[model samples]
Target: MVVDIFIPCFIDQFYPETGFSMVKVLEKAGVTVRYNKNQTCCGQIAFNSGFWDHAKAMGEKFIRDFKDCSHVVAPSASCVGMVRNYYDEMFYNSALHNEYRTLKKNIYEITDFLVNILNVKDTGATFNHVVTWHSSCASLREYGLKDEPGILLRHVRGLKLVEMEDKETCCGFGGMFSVKNEPVSTAMAAHKVEMALKTGAEYIVSTDSSCLMHMQGYISKHNIPLKTIHIVDILASGWEL
Candidate 1:
């Protein structure tokens, strides 16, 4: 199947490798993927921060960018959740409302696309390390993604998926919340990191880069050996590591 890929802002800038890994994984799976260079942020940052006008403009741009694609896939669940869950509300009563509805239905998170549409559990990946999954709040609660990633990870050749404590708890990376409530964000992150570390996991796998970015910062600050990995990276390992 042909699919259009959307790379969120942070992933584009901070985690470009994740995007590459996703492309590699999809291509290896016999899926034809297209990347729209004009695509930018999904307006999630502004929409989440209460900047409706900015969000609407960005959402319209996103809709226009991939209007012809039969399906639009994203590596970040948070970004996909924004388009699927908030685009309609952001464009309500606007000229682009109907367009937003059509675009929203085509958007799918990577794991969701792989597991649900492709109907495949394994991507022939191999990572010989003990790892645990971190369900980002947006991916878990907002998008209702519970088993897609787990199902895929379970089939990886040498990867062991351990259940981390409070798997559903927020990782303290609520985009604007991190800035507005630094103290609370840090406290929550500390607790989440503590729980993750206690699992004796070598790497914490998640679909959203924002959560990994936040947790990586704390992990660096605390000098913890635990590392954050994107699901795409894990899936693209190809038994090499």
Candidate 2:
């Protein structure tokens, strides 16, 4: 199963390891991964900020970048969701509509591709840590990804997965939302961090690195002992502990 891996801008810039970890996990599952160096931002930031013209240009570029690929997968659900859900609105009533429709269907968030499409639950990896899962807003609401990550997490050799309060709540990293509404975003993230800490979780894991990165800021500033790790990294950890 050959698939093009779309590395979201955040992961590509700030957390490149997670992107590579995603590739590692996919290969472990017998997937041949292909990466297009020309791939750039999914334009989600622009779209969310009401910059439709900029977003439309980005949407078109994204489609063109991966048009020849049969399957497309991304680690960030937010990016995947943007391409799948918002591209239509970005390119509505345009000649690109037909191509956009076809592109969206071939694209999948990594966990969705692994669990639903591949029917894969375990990745033969291990992590001996007490952790709680944070379901990013886009993964839960946009992509309707709830249990797929948990199903895969449970298969880790020695991971003790704890359920945090309001696991499905947003981590408040709506890209520009955090910057434009700093107070509210920080408050939401602080509350989320508090909840995860209360669970005695050493790590807060999620399929979306964006959520992890947002919550990580609060965690780091307060000198909290907790860490944020992407699910792909966990699955590819492979007894590294």
lDDT of 1 at 177: 99
- Model 2 misplaced stretches (Cα beyond 4 Å): 239-241
**C-alpha lDDT values of all predictions:** 0.89, 0.89
Candidate 1 weakest lDDT stretch, 10 residues? 88-97
Best-matching candidate per lDDT:
2
Alpha-carbon TM-score of each model against the true structure: 0.97, 0.97
RMSD after Cα superposition, model 2: 1.2
Overall local distance difference test of candidate 1: 0.89
Residue 238 error, candidate 1, Å: 3.0
Q: What is the C-alpha RMSD of each candidate to the true structure, in Å?
A: 1.2, 1.2
What is the lDDT for 120 in model 1?
A: 72
lDDT of each residue in 1-241, candidate 2, tens digit only: 8989999988988999998898888888898999999988888998888998898888889989998888999998889999888887877788887788889889999989999998899998989899998988888888889789999999999899999998888888888999999999999999999999999999999888778889999989999999999999998996454
Query: In model 2, what lDDT does residue 204 have?
Result: 97
